[model samples]
Target: MDQSISSLHMRKLCPNLEREDALDTVLEVPLPEEMFPNRKGGSSSSSTDQDNHYAWLKSQAFNKATDTPPPMLSGRTAELQLLLSVIGSPLIPMPVPFDTAFSNRSVCESSIQASTAKYILQQYIAATGGQAALTSVQSMYVVGKVRMSSSEFHMGNDNSSAAAAVPPSITRNGKSEIGGFVLWQKNPELWFFELIMAGCKMSAGCNGKLAWRQSCSEKSHASRGPPRPLRRSLQGLDPRSTANLFVDAVCIGEKIINDEECFILKLEVSPNVLKSRSASSFDIIRHTVWGYFSQRTGLLMQLEDSHLLRMKSGCSRISASTQISCKSINNDSSIFWETFMESIIDDYRYIDGINIAHNGRTVVTLFRYGEGSINHKRRLEECWTIEEADFNLHGLAMDSFLPPSDLKVDCD
Candidate 1:
């Protein structure tokens, strides 16, 4: 008998004796391109054989390995492995270069900063569409579902075990409508909120002087009421006017981090601003990081936001981080022309040209305090597209409609 066959038979009979012949056979096989087909080409034999061999080898190695224990990983080691795996993965795309062909060393430092900020702002503006287009947008109707989760706090003697209990969860669906206008001698403005959340099922209008909200709940009769005075609510924040404000605010001094020059902007939330009804109930603290804009399109290529505060309790906090990029923008649309005309057709005098329409997706990662202790984090991963947007220059004025006599009024 051959020496290899005799050894194999002896190993099988003894069972306790470790098999060396099988190991030798695998080690002697050539692992070159000739033995394995090129992976780039579509081939079945190489991959199938490789998988089968690996599985067989792994099983055999573990079979008689009673004395050898599996490797144990510490928390830090596991984290490092995860980080390495993420960094090594091909799913993440490389960032676009920040330096532009128009970049010049001779440019003044201040001029460079201003030019860079302006270029970035323009890119963001153009990414949504040109400033002209954005300015013309008057009213936007958005119909989408919103998922909300709620948790009930539990009080117990056992602190550690109490924290381990699962929190109660609830979800709700809703939609929103937003309207924009020119205010304070034609300064651009914007206002929006969830219609259902406010407990009002009616339309609201503002014309700098007068403001109004009508309610049409099932319990209440259809009625048109006087506009609620939200001038104070309307005073400070205007998404359209603040577009440039955001650009300027984020155009802070530059610093080098990890050998890359980055512009860091600290966004602070004022208590006064928070107290205002216009502010959302949720906490939002935004710190934006900016890179140079593309010279050709004059749009921002990359933007990163750190420490996006969503909720805070005691010293514990929940936050999210985000990165946004504009892939493309289309300016020519016949549907836009039709929609713009139809919106202004009734009050032909008041409607203006379409100003801004944008569609994009954002990836958000939520984190909890105590190093992932609290489980209040979620991705809520969603993509939003702006389907219809129209801005009316002349405001529409509706005649007063009376409330129904048999309305069920809740005076609680």
Candidate 2:
């Protein structure tokens, strides 16, 4: 299962990007070779660089690997893992809120905060082409390019041993590696996502009942808790799904984003969902989301997702992002990791009567704390722009969103 989506394959799945009505944007989704540069002093080609690194890692090094993961072979590995933990398994607000709202429009009329959010959501729906246009859409295929990088984990105390485990090569300065992604969606619950970068790739999908994620380095694994829409879809790719996400949300306040005053609607992931995602390795503390809708445009300008989970005592393990779950010597006290992710959605332009967000940036910050006063902070970032979008595909089928056949239950 190579799982790489070629441009030709994408072109066949969706409408032409060069249509007479196409926007000015070229939406270049270049091949990986052109996307990620050589870490081998720019002499070897990307494929050669990748093959050489794979050889080096597999030769004698990978065979005698230690608990501490490799820092960086070149142009990235450690950072790739950080991405796999975050972007590879990204999730949006679930779509269950609509049931209560549609069943009874005044379901939560007693709460002012809830009522205010409903008002904001209505305006948002109208701004993104209204309920009529949104409902007409059945499926979508989105292609886009992205640049990503991660910062080294900074320790507040003298944790030299832990620092050694996280190699310095994993950190990028300002420049980041380029990558591309392809997403096919039938709805919030049924969708497929794939992203390739830095000689690493990841894919995840949900078949309306089960969700699973896989990467170049790891086996396919189930996502914990209830199924949720891909976070990328909410970056203005799917307005209907976004509206469904905030159906029962409450508007607490307003803020200015990108110089635009916006109303903020917030929602907390229910306790049942949190408990479902919990496992023997860790317990999810909270997963909250806040959407900022621009007052002038009435469209969502930004989204912020904050998540917290603590590793259970007596359990020693590391996550895809090794820095996120550093192994502790003492098992008596649990180590807590808080991840704050924010996406500033912008560059909205209509494609086939649907206003889709053409550009956006996502920033993820991770904080780790536990016994021995251990504290650390790390950041990962991604900037993406859509190249093309086609909706209501002719051959789109439910089989496309099926979970991997070899999917293993998530251990965390």
Candidate 3:
């Protein structure tokens, strides 16, 4: 073959190959088989096939260099944002005095379990810092570092040989990414949370009237559900909020965790709250929360909750301009995704007389399956440590917690 013609052919085979390299790098090989002995045969078929494969490999490498990040890596940006909002943010303590309710709950009228739970919570209040100390704080600021990772697993048995041979993309051991977050909060539903990970910033804040989330390269979006307290508040970050959340909860039982006896107080979301959170496309089946208060120290050692969501697809019709036919989706048998999270609180250290969990670990399991689809499980984990915390910040203001200007406040 003519040398110039061969170069042109090579360039055509791989679009990404540079023009100069394609023309100048071609060598007149004395023995092609010696160079690539893996070729099945020295026939025209093998030679052409081998060349095509090489071209493909080169194209893939070129594309990878220029392509956007892998979905898993880019997806972490959003995940970290959610992590900060759910576990990193500090929630403002309700202004209501803790003693008012305690004094009203007659010991004789309440059930044994309920009364016991209340008494335990009072001890928690004292351990966290007395009611006077807790109520004295009007605002909080916190900074922390975290390492987080997420991976999926298969839950059900699949006997197919193909399935058995193709292992999951995520392995038994995976790498985690390091990130940092800062949070600010004031009394009565004002807070801000920001997390930076992998060069992306995830942020969410509430200005008492509007709650929104904003991340890199995306406009802000309002959160679903009625105004709810941030979950991170209960993660030993704010003991007063934790006490209030379980004030009416019944002590379901006791279990030994990490070789320590703990009382389990269970709380389930009210039906009305669930209805307000659910939308046309999404139905919240249930949300239940549990707290594991260490019986030894009267402090919370762990927190857990699980929620199920039923997502219905194909319910809405396309715009008339689209000119397409659609079928109604049955909400009864819609796909379901459930999330369960358990956090182990440890390394409790006193910060300004308040017992704060400085270091903690959380394990999250996400189960996603349709009525007849293969079940897939994803396990996400996060290890967090509080780097700094302060109460009654010198200059924190409500204006600092204002929602982003670009937030989509119209979304239902």
Candidate 4:
């Protein structure tokens, strides 16, 4: 491989951080295993594979589209984009918020569990920051760093193997990919998120009415249902959205997490909402969210959500138009994939009188079922920390949240 190509790839991995945050700070992505010598002290054997990944990540056209939506990003590279950016996220996006996420539960007045959940949320609002403080700010932005990786995979009992061996491509410990993200939010419905990992930059945003996502060299795809909110935002970054998301939740019960007893609030996606997000090729069977609020502190300590998807048989390719999520799937048989994600929020500190979690870890499990002799389980995880956060910025306008020009809306 040309040395220039590798050097160029190195530069491409460097993110353009804010001027204040840029000094002495550099973004680092783990070099492909091929970059180093083999365990036997010989040259690594995977140079060709590494070169292709590097070349695609820094392709001039793709990077150009990331900075200014190129006139086109053809389908030729969609598979590569999907392979490099496989993240599992709920497809149903967040519901549109009214007065408040929690305040809209007047219809379910009779359920004792619902009332208990509401009370738990009310306490959370107070614990994070009083309603007065939370409502006082109109917008906020956060700068953070993240490491993501696919950690493990194993065949289910249906397969012949007693205990499936982990694939060579996957690190049993989920090899971590280091990157940084910049998040800007005006509200639950109007927001933008950009992330760069392994030298590829992917973005998802909602311009108040629509949510779309794009990976480098891939045309953007609008989400199917209502405007979406980035799941990362709800990870102790956006209190308002987090509060509103569980507004209709019912108290499922309590469980001790990390030695802290917490109240569990559960919410399920409505059938109509799921139907709206489903496309002809795939159906989102169910998506349910759970929030665990610390009983003693009255703050949310963890969040977990699981979603099941059934795709048309033989249509194996995961959609590239969706968020920089959706890892690859096998096409051998008609199968169902259930993705479960759990986020543990911690390192809380008061910023401007608001208690905010500065760091967290998320683990995602993707399980394949509905097919005998083909069940597989893959595990992925992400660790993230907030480096900077600020509220009430004056210059962030609706334009900041616009979708790309080449964006294709998937549904009405």
User: Best candidate per TM-score, number?
Assistant: 2
lDDT of each: 0.26, 0.69, 0.59, 0.62
lDDT of 1 by residue, 72-151 (tens): 22222222121111111101111111222123333354455555565555554554454666555443333222111112
Which residue ranges in model 1 land beyond 4 Å of their true spot?
1-115, 123-164, 168-187, 193-242, 250-296, 299-358, 370-376, 393-412
- What lDDT tens digits, residue by residue, belong to model 4 across residues 137-179? 6887787777766644565664333232222333244335676
Residue lDDT tens for model 2, 58-117: 211111013433334343443465565575447774544432322337744349888888
Collision count of model 3 = 0
Collision pairs in model 2: 27-387
Candidate 4 wrongly placed segments (more than 4 Å): 1-93, 101-108, 157-174, 314-333
User: How big is the RMSD of model 4?
Assistant: 10.5
Give the winner by lDDT. Answer: 2
Per-candidate RMSD, Å: 28.8, 7.4, 17.8, 10.5
Task: Supply the TM-score for candidate 4.
Answer: 0.73
Alpha carbon lDDT at 310, candidate 3: 70
Candidate 4, lDDT over the whole model: 0.62
Pick out the ten consecutive residues of candidate 3 with the lowest summed lDDT.
5-14
